[model samples]
Target: MTYAGVNRLLHWLMAALILGLLTLGYYMTYVADYGLYHLHKSVAVVVALLLLPRLVLRWFKPWQSTVKGKGAKAVHGFHWLLLVLLVIMVVSGAAYSGFGGYGIALFDWPLLAQNIDAQQQVVAHSAALSDWGLAVHIYCAWALCFTLAIHALAALKHHFIDRDGTLIRMLVGEKGARL
Candidate 1:
Protein backbone atom coordinates (compact mmCIF):
# COMPACT_ATOMS: atom_id res chain seq x y z
CA MET A 1 0.00 0.00 0.00
CA THR A 2 1.00 3.60 -0.59
CA TYR A 3 2.15 5.78 2.27
CA ALA A 4 -1.05 7.75 2.25
CA GLY A 5 -3.17 4.62 2.34
CA VAL A 6 -1.30 3.29 5.36
CA ASN A 7 -1.50 6.65 7.11
CA ARG A 8 -5.20 7.03 6.44
CA LEU A 9 -6.00 3.59 7.77
CA LEU A 10 -3.88 4.10 10.87
CA HIS A 11 -5.33 7.56 11.44
CA TRP A 12 -8.96 6.48 11.35
CA LEU A 13 -8.40 3.33 13.35
CA MET A 14 -6.43 5.10 16.08
CA ALA A 15 -8.97 7.90 16.21
CA ALA A 16 -11.79 5.46 16.84
CA LEU A 17 -9.86 3.64 19.54
CA ILE A 18 -8.79 6.77 21.35
CA LEU A 19 -12.24 8.31 21.24
CA GLY A 20 -13.91 5.15 22.48
CA LEU A 21 -11.40 4.70 25.28
CA LEU A 22 -11.75 8.31 26.35
CA THR A 23 -15.52 8.09 26.43
CA LEU A 24 -15.42 4.90 28.47
CA GLY A 25 -12.88 6.37 30.89
CA TYR A 26 -15.08 9.40 31.44
CA TYR A 27 -18.16 7.29 32.16
CA MET A 28 -16.36 4.71 34.29
CA THR A 29 -15.22 7.31 36.79
CA TYR A 30 -18.74 8.14 37.87
CA VAL A 31 -19.64 4.51 38.57
CA ALA A 32 -18.33 3.21 41.91
CA ASP A 33 -17.64 -0.30 40.72
CA TYR A 34 -14.13 -1.75 40.73
CA GLY A 35 -14.95 -4.09 37.84
CA LEU A 36 -16.05 -1.24 35.57
CA TYR A 37 -12.95 0.72 36.50
CA HIS A 38 -10.82 -2.29 35.64
CA LEU A 39 -12.51 -2.49 32.28
CA HIS A 40 -11.71 1.16 31.61
CA LYS A 41 -8.08 0.67 32.60
CA SER A 42 -7.80 -2.37 30.40
CA VAL A 43 -9.04 -0.44 27.40
CA ALA A 44 -6.56 2.32 28.19
CA VAL A 45 -3.67 -0.13 28.39
CA VAL A 46 -4.63 -1.55 25.00
CA VAL A 47 -4.77 1.91 23.52
CA ALA A 48 -1.30 2.66 24.88
CA LEU A 49 0.11 -0.51 23.35
CA LEU A 50 -1.52 0.19 20.00
CA LEU A 51 -0.32 3.78 19.99
CA LEU A 52 3.31 2.77 20.58
CA PRO A 53 3.35 0.57 17.51
CA ARG A 54 1.53 3.17 15.45
CA LEU A 55 4.09 5.77 16.40
CA VAL A 56 6.90 3.46 15.44
CA LEU A 57 5.22 2.75 12.09
CA ARG A 58 4.82 6.43 11.42
CA TRP A 59 8.47 6.97 12.11
CA PHE A 60 9.58 4.22 9.73
CA LYS A 61 7.16 5.12 6.93
CA PRO A 62 7.89 8.08 4.72
CA TRP A 63 5.19 10.75 4.72
CA GLN A 64 3.78 11.81 1.36
CA SER A 65 4.72 15.39 0.65
CA THR A 66 1.70 17.67 0.67
CA VAL A 67 1.17 21.28 -0.38
CA LYS A 68 3.33 23.61 1.71
CA GLY A 69 0.75 26.29 2.30
CA LYS A 70 0.94 28.15 5.63
CA GLY A 71 -2.32 26.57 6.71
CA ALA A 72 -1.02 23.12 5.92
CA LYS A 73 2.17 23.70 7.90
CA ALA A 74 0.17 24.85 10.89
CA VAL A 75 -2.05 21.82 10.67
CA HIS A 76 0.95 19.51 10.54
CA GLY A 77 2.43 21.19 13.60
CA PHE A 78 -0.79 20.69 15.47
CA HIS A 79 -0.76 17.02 14.52
CA TRP A 80 2.78 16.55 15.83
CA LEU A 81 1.86 18.25 19.09
CA LEU A 82 -1.19 16.06 19.45
CA LEU A 83 0.88 12.93 18.94
CA VAL A 84 3.36 13.88 21.66
CA LEU A 85 0.60 14.80 24.10
CA LEU A 86 -1.24 11.56 23.47
CA VAL A 87 1.82 9.51 24.31
CA ILE A 88 2.38 11.47 27.48
CA MET A 89 -1.23 11.06 28.52
CA VAL A 90 -1.18 7.34 28.01
CA VAL A 91 2.10 6.69 29.81
CA SER A 92 1.29 8.96 32.74
CA GLY A 93 -2.15 7.46 33.14
CA ALA A 94 -0.83 3.91 33.17
CA ALA A 95 1.91 4.79 35.63
CA TYR A 96 -0.44 6.63 37.94
CA SER A 97 -3.00 3.84 38.02
CA GLY A 98 -0.40 1.14 38.56
CA PHE A 99 1.25 3.08 41.32
CA GLY A 100 -2.05 3.19 43.17
CA GLY A 101 -1.89 -0.57 43.86
CA TYR A 102 -4.38 -1.34 41.11
CA GLY A 103 -2.87 -3.67 38.57
CA ILE A 104 -4.96 -3.03 35.47
CA ALA A 105 -4.49 -5.60 32.77
CA LEU A 106 -5.88 -7.00 29.55
CA PHE A 107 -6.88 -10.63 30.04
CA ASP A 108 -3.91 -11.80 32.12
CA TRP A 109 -1.20 -9.55 30.72
CA PRO A 110 0.00 -6.77 32.93
CA LEU A 111 0.98 -3.79 30.80
CA LEU A 112 2.18 -1.32 33.42
CA ALA A 113 4.59 -1.00 36.30
CA GLN A 114 3.72 -3.11 39.34
CA ASN A 115 2.88 -1.27 42.53
CA ILE A 116 4.91 -2.50 45.50
CA ASP A 117 3.20 -0.68 48.32
CA ALA A 118 3.45 -2.33 51.72
CA GLN A 119 1.13 0.10 53.52
CA GLN A 120 -2.15 1.88 52.94
CA GLN A 121 -0.43 5.27 53.22
CA VAL A 122 1.76 4.47 50.21
CA VAL A 123 -1.31 3.46 48.23
CA ALA A 124 -3.06 6.65 49.28
CA HIS A 125 -0.12 8.73 48.10
CA SER A 126 -0.14 6.92 44.80
CA ALA A 127 -3.85 7.63 44.46
CA ALA A 128 -3.01 11.33 44.47
CA LEU A 129 -0.71 10.73 41.52
CA SER A 130 -3.56 9.02 39.74
CA ASP A 131 -5.77 12.03 40.35
CA TRP A 132 -3.19 14.39 38.85
CA GLY A 133 -2.67 12.10 35.89
CA LEU A 134 -6.40 11.93 35.32
CA ALA A 135 -6.60 15.71 35.22
CA VAL A 136 -3.87 15.93 32.60
CA HIS A 137 -5.47 13.14 30.59
CA ILE A 138 -8.77 15.02 30.42
CA TYR A 139 -7.07 18.23 29.38
CA CYS A 140 -5.08 16.54 26.60
CA ALA A 141 -8.19 14.76 25.35
CA TRP A 142 -10.15 17.99 24.97
CA ALA A 143 -7.25 19.53 23.08
CA LEU A 144 -7.06 16.52 20.81
CA CYS A 145 -10.80 16.70 20.11
CA PHE A 146 -10.49 20.37 19.14
CA THR A 147 -7.53 19.64 16.89
CA LEU A 148 -9.42 16.79 15.20
CA ALA A 149 -12.35 19.09 14.48
CA ILE A 150 -10.01 21.60 12.88
CA HIS A 151 -8.24 18.87 10.92
CA ALA A 152 -11.53 17.57 9.52
CA LEU A 153 -12.74 21.04 8.61
CA ALA A 154 -9.47 21.79 6.87
CA ALA A 155 -9.77 18.62 4.79
CA LEU A 156 -13.31 19.56 3.79
CA LYS A 157 -12.11 23.03 2.82
CA HIS A 158 -9.40 21.57 0.63
CA HIS A 159 -11.86 19.21 -1.02
CA PHE A 160 -14.48 21.86 -1.72
CA ILE A 161 -12.74 25.22 -2.07
CA ASP A 162 -9.07 24.66 -2.82
CA ARG A 163 -9.81 22.07 -5.48
CA ASP A 164 -6.53 20.48 -4.54
CA GLY A 165 -5.85 16.79 -3.97
CA THR A 166 -4.89 17.35 -0.33
CA LEU A 167 -7.73 15.31 1.06
CA ILE A 168 -7.70 12.80 -1.77
CA ARG A 169 -4.00 12.05 -1.29
CA MET A 170 -4.66 10.83 2.26
CA LEU A 171 -8.07 9.32 1.60
CA VAL A 172 -7.39 7.61 -1.75
CA GLY A 173 -3.58 7.40 -1.83
CA GLU A 174 -3.21 9.42 -5.02
CA LYS A 175 -0.62 12.12 -4.49
CA GLY A 176 -0.85 15.07 -6.87
CA ALA A 177 2.35 15.30 -8.95
CA ARG A 178 2.87 18.91 -7.94
CA LEU A 179 1.95 20.71 -4.70
Candidate 2:
Protein backbone atom coordinates (compact mmCIF):
# COMPACT_ATOMS: atom_id res chain seq x y z
CA MET A 1 0.00 0.00 0.00
CA THR A 2 1.22 3.50 -0.83
CA TYR A 3 1.08 6.23 1.77
CA ALA A 4 1.31 9.70 0.35
CA GLY A 5 4.41 11.81 0.95
CA VAL A 6 2.29 14.43 2.66
CA ASN A 7 1.09 11.90 5.19
CA ARG A 8 4.62 10.82 6.07
CA LEU A 9 5.75 14.42 6.36
CA LEU A 10 2.89 15.34 8.65
CA HIS A 11 3.45 12.29 10.85
CA TRP A 12 7.11 13.05 11.49
CA LEU A 13 6.54 16.78 11.82
CA MET A 14 3.78 16.30 14.36
CA ALA A 15 5.90 13.82 16.25
CA ALA A 16 8.61 16.43 16.61
CA LEU A 17 6.14 19.11 17.63
CA ILE A 18 4.54 16.92 20.30
CA LEU A 19 7.88 15.82 21.70
CA GLY A 20 9.20 19.37 21.81
CA LEU A 21 6.08 20.79 23.44
CA LEU A 22 6.05 18.04 26.06
CA THR A 23 9.65 18.71 26.95
CA LEU A 24 9.15 22.46 27.04
CA GLY A 25 6.07 22.12 29.23
CA TYR A 26 7.94 19.96 31.73
CA TYR A 27 10.94 22.25 31.81
CA MET A 28 9.12 25.57 32.05
CA THR A 29 7.01 24.44 35.00
CA TYR A 30 10.10 24.36 37.20
CA VAL A 31 12.38 26.86 35.44
CA ALA A 32 10.01 29.79 36.03
CA ASP A 33 11.20 31.70 33.00
CA TYR A 34 8.71 33.81 31.10
CA GLY A 35 10.67 33.11 27.93
CA LEU A 36 10.29 29.38 28.43
CA TYR A 37 6.59 29.75 29.06
CA HIS A 38 6.23 31.78 25.92
CA LEU A 39 8.17 29.22 23.98
CA HIS A 40 5.99 26.43 25.31
CA LYS A 41 2.85 28.29 24.40
CA SER A 42 4.20 28.98 20.95
CA VAL A 43 4.94 25.32 20.35
CA ALA A 44 1.46 24.43 21.53
CA VAL A 45 -0.06 26.81 19.02
CA VAL A 46 1.88 25.09 16.25
CA VAL A 47 0.67 21.72 17.51
CA ALA A 48 -2.91 22.95 17.49
CA LEU A 49 -2.56 24.18 13.92
CA LEU A 50 -1.03 20.94 12.68
CA LEU A 51 -3.60 18.85 14.54
CA LEU A 52 -6.56 20.18 12.56
CA PRO A 53 -5.14 19.21 9.19
CA ARG A 54 -3.81 15.92 10.54
CA LEU A 55 -7.25 14.89 11.77
CA VAL A 56 -8.80 15.80 8.45
CA LEU A 57 -6.17 13.88 6.53
CA ARG A 58 -6.60 10.85 8.75
CA TRP A 59 -10.27 10.67 7.87
CA PHE A 60 -9.84 11.37 4.17
CA LYS A 61 -6.67 9.33 3.58
CA PRO A 62 -6.45 6.60 6.16
CA TRP A 63 -3.24 4.70 6.71
CA GLN A 64 -2.87 1.30 5.13
CA SER A 65 -2.87 -1.72 7.43
CA THR A 66 0.28 -3.81 7.43
CA VAL A 67 -0.77 -6.42 9.95
CA LYS A 68 -3.46 -9.02 9.36
CA GLY A 69 -3.88 -10.71 12.74
CA LYS A 70 -6.55 -10.18 15.42
CA GLY A 71 -3.98 -8.54 17.66
CA ALA A 72 -3.22 -6.18 14.82
CA LYS A 73 -6.82 -5.00 14.82
CA ALA A 74 -6.64 -4.43 18.56
CA VAL A 75 -3.47 -2.38 18.09
CA HIS A 76 -5.13 -0.31 15.41
CA GLY A 77 -8.05 0.34 17.74
CA PHE A 78 -5.64 1.53 20.40
CA HIS A 79 -4.05 3.80 17.81
CA TRP A 80 -7.40 5.44 17.14
CA LEU A 81 -7.88 5.90 20.85
CA LEU A 82 -4.47 7.55 21.00
CA LEU A 83 -5.47 9.93 18.25
CA VAL A 84 -8.56 10.98 20.21
CA LEU A 85 -6.54 11.45 23.36
CA LEU A 86 -4.03 13.56 21.41
CA VAL A 87 -6.79 15.87 20.20
CA ILE A 88 -8.07 16.24 23.74
CA MET A 89 -4.60 17.09 24.95
CA VAL A 90 -4.02 19.67 22.22
CA VAL A 91 -7.41 21.37 22.59
CA SER A 92 -7.26 21.52 26.37
CA GLY A 93 -3.74 22.88 26.27
CA ALA A 94 -4.74 25.57 23.79
CA ALA A 95 -7.81 26.54 25.80
CA TYR A 96 -5.84 26.73 29.02
CA SER A 97 -3.15 28.87 27.47
CA GLY A 98 -5.53 31.14 25.61
CA PHE A 99 -7.71 31.70 28.66
CA GLY A 100 -4.83 32.16 31.04
CA GLY A 101 -4.85 35.84 30.04
CA TYR A 102 -1.69 35.18 28.08
CA GLY A 103 -0.88 36.53 24.65
CA ILE A 104 -0.46 33.89 21.95
CA ALA A 105 0.12 34.39 18.28
CA LEU A 106 1.15 32.61 15.16
CA PHE A 107 3.84 34.88 13.71
CA ASP A 108 2.02 37.96 15.05
CA TRP A 109 -1.41 36.77 13.97
CA PRO A 110 -3.76 36.26 16.91
CA LEU A 111 -5.83 33.08 16.83
CA LEU A 112 -8.07 33.39 19.90
CA ALA A 113 -10.76 35.90 20.67
CA GLN A 114 -9.72 39.41 21.58
CA ASN A 115 -10.51 41.40 24.77
CA ILE A 116 -11.28 38.13 26.51
CA ASP A 117 -11.90 39.95 29.79
CA ALA A 118 -14.00 42.92 28.60
CA GLN A 119 -16.77 41.74 30.90
CA GLN A 120 -16.40 40.68 34.54
CA GLN A 121 -18.29 37.49 33.82
CA VAL A 122 -15.93 36.58 30.97
CA VAL A 123 -12.95 36.76 33.29
CA ALA A 124 -14.64 34.54 35.81
CA HIS A 125 -15.69 32.07 33.15
CA SER A 126 -12.24 31.97 31.57
CA ALA A 127 -10.60 31.44 34.93
CA ALA A 128 -12.80 28.44 35.59
CA LEU A 129 -12.21 27.02 32.14
CA SER A 130 -8.44 27.47 32.46
CA ASP A 131 -8.32 25.51 35.71
CA TRP A 132 -10.24 22.49 34.43
CA GLY A 133 -8.58 22.54 31.04
CA LEU A 134 -5.12 22.63 32.59
CA ALA A 135 -5.89 19.70 34.84
CA VAL A 136 -7.15 17.56 31.96
CA HIS A 137 -4.22 18.60 29.78
CA ILE A 138 -1.66 17.54 32.37
CA TYR A 139 -3.35 14.21 33.03
CA CYS A 140 -3.72 13.40 29.35
CA ALA A 141 -0.09 14.32 28.66
CA TRP A 142 1.16 11.84 31.24
CA ALA A 143 -1.10 9.14 29.90
CA LEU A 144 0.02 9.90 26.36
CA CYS A 145 3.68 9.59 27.29
CA PHE A 146 3.09 6.19 28.85
CA THR A 147 1.12 4.99 25.87
CA LEU A 148 3.78 6.31 23.50
CA ALA A 149 6.47 4.28 25.19
CA ILE A 150 4.38 1.14 24.92
CA HIS A 151 3.54 1.84 21.31
CA ALA A 152 7.20 2.34 20.42
CA LEU A 153 8.19 -0.93 22.06
CA ALA A 154 5.41 -2.75 20.28
CA ALA A 155 6.61 -1.35 16.96
CA LEU A 156 10.11 -2.51 17.73
CA LYS A 157 8.78 -5.99 18.51
CA HIS A 158 7.03 -6.09 15.19
CA HIS A 159 10.18 -4.96 13.43
CA PHE A 160 12.53 -7.46 15.10
CA ILE A 161 10.87 -10.41 16.79
CA ASP A 162 7.70 -10.65 14.76
CA ARG A 163 9.71 -9.87 11.60
CA ASP A 164 6.71 -7.98 10.32
CA GLY A 165 6.31 -4.65 8.57
CA THR A 166 4.22 -2.83 11.14
CA LEU A 167 6.96 -0.37 11.97
CA ILE A 168 8.06 -0.07 8.36
CA ARG A 169 4.55 0.75 7.24
CA MET A 170 4.58 3.86 9.45
CA LEU A 171 8.18 4.97 8.99
CA VAL A 172 8.21 4.21 5.29
CA GLY A 173 5.47 4.20 2.68
CA GLU A 174 5.34 0.48 2.04
CA LYS A 175 5.81 -2.82 3.86
CA GLY A 176 8.29 -5.27 2.40
CA ALA A 177 6.48 -8.38 1.35
CA ARG A 178 8.11 -11.72 2.13
CA LEU A 179 9.05 -13.84 -0.85
Candidate 3:
Protein backbone atom coordinates (compact mmCIF):
# COMPACT_ATOMS: atom_id res chain seq x y z
CA MET A 1 0.00 0.00 0.00
CA THR A 2 0.98 3.61 -0.42
CA TYR A 3 0.97 6.44 2.03
CA ALA A 4 -1.74 9.07 1.84
CA GLY A 5 -1.04 12.34 0.09
CA VAL A 6 -0.75 14.17 3.36
CA ASN A 7 1.66 11.54 4.61
CA ARG A 8 3.76 11.69 1.47
CA LEU A 9 3.86 15.44 1.51
CA LEU A 10 4.85 15.62 5.13
CA HIS A 11 7.50 12.98 4.62
CA TRP A 12 9.16 14.76 1.71
CA LEU A 13 8.89 18.20 3.24
CA MET A 14 10.35 17.01 6.51
CA ALA A 15 13.13 15.21 4.69
CA ALA A 16 14.18 18.42 2.97
CA LEU A 17 13.84 20.53 6.07
CA ILE A 18 15.82 18.10 8.17
CA LEU A 19 18.55 17.82 5.60
CA GLY A 20 18.82 21.60 5.30
CA LEU A 21 18.84 22.00 9.05
CA LEU A 22 21.56 19.39 9.42
CA THR A 23 23.71 21.10 6.84
CA LEU A 24 23.19 24.47 8.53
CA GLY A 25 24.02 22.97 11.88
CA TYR A 26 27.27 21.50 10.58
CA TYR A 27 28.26 24.70 8.84
CA MET A 28 27.46 26.82 11.87
CA THR A 29 29.63 24.70 14.14
CA TYR A 30 32.54 23.71 11.94
CA VAL A 31 32.69 26.79 9.72
CA ALA A 32 33.26 28.96 12.78
CA ASP A 33 30.39 31.34 12.19
CA TYR A 34 28.82 31.95 15.57
CA GLY A 35 26.41 34.40 13.94
CA LEU A 36 24.52 31.59 12.25
CA TYR A 37 23.40 30.31 15.62
CA HIS A 38 20.32 32.52 15.62
CA LEU A 39 19.25 31.43 12.18
CA HIS A 40 19.88 27.80 13.04
CA LYS A 41 17.84 27.97 16.21
CA SER A 42 14.95 29.68 14.43
CA VAL A 43 14.82 27.09 11.68
CA ALA A 44 15.04 24.38 14.30
CA VAL A 45 11.92 25.74 15.98
CA VAL A 46 10.13 25.62 12.65
CA VAL A 47 11.20 21.99 12.30
CA ALA A 48 9.85 21.19 15.73
CA LEU A 49 6.52 22.77 14.87
CA LEU A 50 6.19 20.81 11.67
CA LEU A 51 7.22 17.55 13.33
CA LEU A 52 4.60 17.81 16.06
CA PRO A 53 1.76 17.66 13.59
CA ARG A 54 3.39 14.97 11.49
CA LEU A 55 3.85 12.74 14.50
CA VAL A 56 0.24 13.15 15.53
CA LEU A 57 -0.98 12.43 12.00
CA ARG A 58 1.13 9.30 11.77
CA TRP A 59 -0.24 8.06 15.05
CA PHE A 60 -3.88 8.62 14.15
CA LYS A 61 -3.77 7.56 10.51
CA PRO A 62 -1.24 4.78 10.29
CA TRP A 63 -0.15 3.65 6.84
CA GLN A 64 -0.26 0.04 5.73
CA SER A 65 2.96 -1.32 4.33
CA THR A 66 3.22 -2.73 0.82
CA VAL A 67 6.11 -4.86 2.00
CA LYS A 68 5.14 -7.89 4.04
CA GLY A 69 6.83 -9.86 6.85
CA LYS A 70 10.20 -8.88 8.29
CA GLY A 71 10.86 -6.00 5.95
CA ALA A 72 7.67 -4.27 6.98
CA LYS A 73 8.42 -4.83 10.64
CA ALA A 74 11.89 -3.42 10.30
CA VAL A 75 10.65 -0.40 8.39
CA HIS A 76 8.03 0.35 10.99
CA GLY A 77 10.56 0.04 13.79
CA PHE A 78 13.02 2.32 12.03
CA HIS A 79 10.36 4.96 11.48
CA TRP A 80 9.58 5.00 15.18
CA LEU A 81 13.24 5.24 16.09
CA LEU A 82 13.70 8.13 13.68
CA LEU A 83 10.79 9.98 15.22
CA VAL A 84 12.22 9.51 18.70
CA LEU A 85 15.61 10.74 17.62
CA LEU A 86 14.06 13.82 16.02
CA VAL A 87 12.21 14.69 19.21
CA ILE A 88 15.37 14.29 21.21
CA MET A 89 17.27 16.50 18.81
CA VAL A 90 14.66 19.24 18.93
CA VAL A 91 14.60 19.27 22.72
CA SER A 92 18.34 19.21 23.06
CA GLY A 93 18.78 22.01 20.55
CA ALA A 94 16.25 24.17 22.33
CA ALA A 95 17.98 23.61 25.64
CA TYR A 96 21.39 24.33 24.22
CA SER A 97 20.28 27.64 22.75
CA GLY A 98 17.68 28.64 25.30
CA PHE A 99 19.89 28.00 28.28
CA GLY A 100 22.74 29.81 26.66
CA GLY A 101 20.71 32.94 27.57
CA TYR A 102 20.42 34.37 24.07
CA GLY A 103 16.92 35.06 22.85
CA ILE A 104 15.67 32.82 20.04
CA ALA A 105 14.26 34.58 17.01
CA LEU A 106 12.05 33.52 14.16
CA PHE A 107 12.97 35.66 11.20
CA ASP A 108 13.05 39.01 13.01
CA TRP A 109 10.51 38.31 15.74
CA PRO A 110 11.94 37.39 19.09
CA LEU A 111 10.64 34.39 21.01
CA LEU A 112 13.03 34.77 23.93
CA ALA A 113 14.49 37.99 25.18
CA GLN A 114 18.09 38.72 24.32
CA ASN A 115 19.66 39.24 27.68
CA ILE A 116 23.14 40.26 26.60
CA ASP A 117 25.26 43.06 28.00
CA ALA A 118 26.99 45.99 26.28
CA GLN A 119 29.99 43.69 25.92
CA GLN A 120 27.76 41.31 23.88
CA GLN A 121 28.14 38.68 26.54
CA VAL A 122 25.43 36.05 26.80
CA VAL A 123 24.02 34.88 30.08
CA ALA A 124 26.05 32.15 31.70
CA HIS A 125 24.98 28.52 31.48
CA SER A 126 25.93 25.89 33.98
CA ALA A 127 28.81 23.80 32.72
CA ALA A 128 26.94 20.54 33.26
CA LEU A 129 23.65 21.59 31.59
CA SER A 130 25.16 23.29 28.56
CA ASP A 131 27.61 20.48 27.98
CA TRP A 132 24.94 17.83 28.25
CA GLY A 133 22.61 19.68 25.91
CA LEU A 134 25.29 20.33 23.30
CA ALA A 135 26.48 16.74 23.43
CA VAL A 136 22.98 15.29 23.07
CA HIS A 137 22.06 17.70 20.29
CA ILE A 138 25.22 16.92 18.33
CA TYR A 139 24.99 13.16 18.83
CA CYS A 140 21.32 13.04 17.89
CA ALA A 141 21.98 15.06 14.73
CA TRP A 142 24.67 12.60 13.62
CA ALA A 143 22.39 9.70 14.48
CA LEU A 144 19.65 11.22 12.37
CA CYS A 145 21.98 11.63 9.41
CA PHE A 146 23.07 8.00 9.69
CA THR A 147 19.48 6.79 10.04
CA LEU A 148 18.36 8.84 7.02
CA ALA A 149 21.15 7.31 4.95
CA ILE A 150 19.98 3.82 5.87
CA HIS A 151 16.41 4.78 5.06
CA ALA A 152 17.31 6.11 1.63
CA LEU A 153 19.45 3.06 0.88
CA ALA A 154 16.58 0.78 1.79
CA ALA A 155 14.24 2.64 -0.56
CA LEU A 156 16.79 2.36 -3.34
CA LYS A 157 17.19 -1.35 -2.69
CA HIS A 158 13.47 -1.88 -2.84
CA HIS A 159 13.14 0.10 -6.03
CA PHE A 160 16.16 -1.25 -7.93
CA ILE A 161 17.21 -4.51 -6.35
CA ASP A 162 13.94 -6.01 -5.11
CA ARG A 163 11.94 -4.44 -7.95
CA ASP A 164 9.28 -3.51 -5.42
CA GLY A 165 6.77 -0.64 -5.48
CA THR A 166 7.83 0.76 -2.13
CA LEU A 167 9.60 3.82 -3.46
CA ILE A 168 6.94 4.50 -6.07
CA ARG A 169 4.23 4.10 -3.46
CA MET A 170 5.87 6.82 -1.40
CA LEU A 171 6.37 9.02 -4.40
CA VAL A 172 2.92 8.80 -6.00
CA GLY A 173 0.64 6.99 -3.58
CA GLU A 174 -1.06 3.55 -3.94
CA LYS A 175 -2.76 4.19 -7.26
CA GLY A 176 -1.14 1.53 -9.44
CA ALA A 177 -0.05 -2.03 -8.73
CA ARG A 178 3.39 -2.81 -7.27
CA LEU A 179 5.97 -2.41 -10.06
Name the lDDT value of residue 82 in candidate 2. 73
Candidate 3 lDDT by residue in tens digits, 18-130: 99999998998898898888788888888888899889987887667667899788878898899999999988876776776766788688887766878988874554676
Query: If scored against the real structure, what TM-score would every candidate get?
Result: 0.74, 0.81, 0.89
lDDT of 3 at 156: 92
Error of 1 at 57 (Å): 3.8
| TM-score-based ranking | 3, 2, 1
- Give the candidates in order of lDDT, highest first: 3, 2, 1
Worst 10 residues of 3 by lDDT: 123-132
Off by over 4 Å in 3: 1-3, 176-179
Which parts of model 2 have CA positions greater than 4 angstroms off? 1-3, 113-125, 175-179
Q: Which 10 successive residues of model 1 have the least lDDT summed?
A: 116-125
Give candidate 2's error at residue 40 in angstroms.
1.8
lDDT tens per residue, model 1, 1-179:
75556677877777787788767766766664556766677767677777776678767863444557785566667767768877877866765676565666785677543555665333534677877776777777777777778878977888899877777776555644244
Measured by TM-score, the strongest candidate is 3
Query: lDDT of all the models against the reference?
Result: 0.69, 0.73, 0.82
